[model samples]
Target: MKESGLPDRYENDAAEKLSPEKQLSPEQQDLKNAIKAFCIAHQHDEHAVFLIEGDAGTGKSIVINSIFNEIQSLSRSSDKSSPFWKTDNYLVVNHPEMMKLYKNISESYPALKKKDFERPTTFINRMHKSGKKADIIFVDEAHLLLTKSDKYNHFKQGNHLEELIKLARITVLVFDEKQVLKFKSCWSQGLLKSLVRGLPCQTYHLKTQFRVHAHQDVLDWIEGFCQKKILPMPQKQTFDLRFFADAQDLYDAIKKENARYRLSRMIATYDYPYRLDGEDHFIREGRFTLRWDRSKPDEKLPWAERPDTIDEVGSVYTVQGFDLNYVGLILGPSVLYDPVTDGIRIDTSRYEDGAAFTGRDGLQDPEGTKERIMLNAINVLMTRAVHGLFIYASDPALRKRLVQMQASRDAA
Candidate 1:
């Protein structure tokens, strides 16, 4: 009897009841104005830099887009002779795409250097050299900024973010530090923080979550790790686990219902499949293809290019920037649960080394690192669903811990 296509629940009600400005917290509003003011003031002061940092679902992208709009408005009002090309003023640097996502830039900004536009690094550098330093530069998912290393040669390690800082007076780098799921050499908040250390930079934190309904209670759980303590798990029995269940049953039900859930967004976090013993590749209840086509340098092997099916399920790494109406998560053994310590651990040794865990077994880690990783991965995975979450736990103890955590928080 469940009708679906994402949740209508209170999402529309919330939107209808709240004005756009009212939707944002006072702090968020202040930050918006401050950002706008900074751009207006530093429009003439090239090399002035600004940084915006916040965790996932914090409206970072929204803020960046707003500032870009303001800059465009201001540019049109200014003299036409300005050397800074308006088209090049707003640069979005992100990972390489199999699909041609940057084509609009070529058509919209004909002045863009054809050669440089193909690569993020080259395009960013060319814009920097153009002397306008871009009135504002917005980098999405910036936590993935590469630090200098042998593996990545596209941009100088450590310098790419630094150079972006140097190139623009007002640069807003929006990313979630928690998303630094992988501890790569290039991972350093210090590089970004250092750039705006002493300047007029005032860190603005957006803690109000507009994404999930107040009844959902997931935000309360995620607050355990966010920088701003604005959201803490409220002790309430109002938590709803009605839509969640074991991965197999959940997938079967979804398939039977023929509901409206994207296959790609239904994700799974498996324990190290490596120790499973016999299987060459693992398959879950849902329909999905697992291919180990020799992992590409930047792409994860056990992942897909994009959401191609309505019943898609993928690993944590593949679902970072995506979201869905309902999420079906198969939590594998990559995360270890220590019953004695009541802690979680994430084994990352085989992550970059291309170790494939194809069996029912998982990996091992001495420290609680694997647990922490698993917890973080769960946080990310569960948050992806706007309406519902279905988690398939391979580890019973871990599942008990999660349920207990949810219960204790709700009861509190």
Candidate 2:
């Protein structure tokens, strides 16, 4: 993996991997070809949407990136017979950090330009104001697209997916319902399908696991935990899954892993207080106190790539959609163990990230939705580790239960 927490296949120097037929798994290659065929067959269609659905680490980004690279290459080719010749195309991602990584990768290839990447809001407003439409548009992290009008983001159109489909002849996007992190950008499979109901649309589901090398049992354990089922930790000798009682010990272990593996870093849930006010904010858990990641206005590298960030704790906003060799996850106070019910409980009142719950007033079962969002945040943080996963929970009962689960697995 690259220092930026991206897989080496996506490194700027790995330009050859961007080719459609190179370095892609069979599943990824098939999806890329399918998307390519869809775009060509529907080039003149009024509106077409191709939805790629996959869990985190299923190589959705790889497929989309390769397909976009091929599109750009063919569009700029001298062959006039090529259907993609001189086609106006762009790639937009809702996350700023992921956008930086995409722009960085674009610099290494001649066919791609840094400007080809944009935020969904920027691309939407720009196209609206300029009265220009793209031939094909690729959206990464489409799950982050705003489902409702977010004035804070300067997006008044309400639904970004709907607008993107209108502004492009064919819109290809990757979505994961599990990764939807906030109420403002909340999305569901049914809602996504409803948006493209009248349009020409096709869906593809990727089942391969390209990111996490852990066993199927380990993945199942994580899924069960995220779904509120506290299952026993699986025994996996190849993939390290450790539970730490002390937050400081978890941080130390993560640092050692980073020394051995360049891409390892520590991340936490949004249970700590933080803001982008150009000041330092810290996640205080007993003796383990580390500052939350800050927004670097002039930094070109992603949060995990920067050398100094090793000393900080990353939130979902910084590490989502990225890879890390080893991840030390700090589950904050919002996550608790309800012994009475013998299940996991999410204490929504303890969550410090109020922004996540903002604009959730009209939503059905607002409290339940908020709880699910919190769980999703934990799911994203937990899945970031490619090689190993180390966890520290702030709630004593929850941490004790996790320790017991690990102990039982070790005994077996």
Candidate 3:
């Protein structure tokens, strides 16, 4: 029973996790106020879909949580017979780490957590079985929601995205298209329109970044870097960007910094093979030998956020949808900077996301599909740092290309 992936002790620990209050930026507050009004106004509507879109550090989570808490407060204040009071709502996420975070948080807030948090696949399957649907659903990290039916979710009839939105009268999604890490996940204007072809829909965007401080230059640099846009040569002064020739040195620096200040992490590309098992396995690169985090024996905080997990490296799954004080990133073999083309080239064969390569859903473009997935993964890893980011490129030529591109004095 313990091997089923959901164990009794896990549930017990999940019930004890804490969620603190978040101070919202003016933009996050406005968005939350607007969405709260909309939800309350149409509390009885059986078919409304609203999209709240933003890139990383844009306070999407704060807005979502604020709106949810406000709604829950209003609901409890009203009499039970009121439509707003009796309506059931949920906050669904696709990432397991985030789901665990919210579920543990919900443990503290019973008024909100009462059947209120879940993964999309699990929520959809339960709704199908019980013939029940939510009045409203808040989907964070909607881009990570899967479409392809995996081994565990093969019983579902169609796309989980479609099934999810349809199960709610109003589905509010916080999304970023570029954050789609796997080939099966998608969140786009086209997808929303197709899912609800005839229904009128509303949209919102959060432009102000609330995560990383002094984040615009870092974001701009990332945009230009990923798009292959040759902007003015980058300066290391802004947000502490540095590229290193050695992976070990970069990791050691991150560790030293972490000792002074916690919450720093080492994250890397999925160019190396990874599995959740093997408690003893370690990734050996350069002088640094690091292990991927083993599965959580219980439902608690994520490996990336835990102090004890300092030695274990994080991949796309553990680090996405979260921020760190500093990040030491290793760009692996699958993504390489091309000297001939003067741009980056994604080698699909070198990537290790096996699900993307399989023709599981019978729609496989091979190179194009895997290339997009790999690029998206890198894009996510690059943006997770709040104050500092150091990088080491495994491919020497790519490392040299990066050095020449920014060629910061820090490196010199």
TM-score of candidate 2 on Cα atoms, chains taken together: 0.95
The residue-by-residue lDDT of candidate 1 on 73-191, one tens digit each, is: 44554556643335346545454431122322233332332232233466555765676555566665676554332234456434466666676666666656566443332334565
Those runs of model 2 whose alpha carbons end farther than 4 Å from true positions after fitting are 1-22
Q: Write the per-residue lDDT of candidate 2 for residues 266-326, one digit (tens) a residue.
A: 8999988887788999999999999999888568888878778899999999988887878
Output the better candidate (1/3) by TM-score: 3
Clashing pairs in 3: none
Look at candidate 1 and tell me the lDDT of residue 76. 53
Question: What residue runs in model 3 are displaced by over 4 Å at the alpha carbon?
Answer: 1-20, 78-83, 228-233, 359-364, 404-412
Every model's Cα RMSD, please?
A: 8.0, 3.2, 7.1
- Candidate 2: global Cα-lDDT? 0.86
Strongest candidate by TM-score? 2
**Regions of candidate 1 where Cα sits further than 4 Å from its true position:** 1-29, 76-88, 96-120, 125-132, 150-153, 185-189, 214-217, 223-245, 253-258, 261-264, 270-307, 349-375, 400-412
Candidate 3, poorest ten consecutive residues by summed lDDT: 1-10
| Predicted candidate 3 versus true structure: per-residue lDDT over 205-323, tens digit per residue | 98876555554556776776666443444454536677788888988889876776667888888877777555455666778788876677484786666887778878888888777
lDDT of model 3 at residue 254? 91
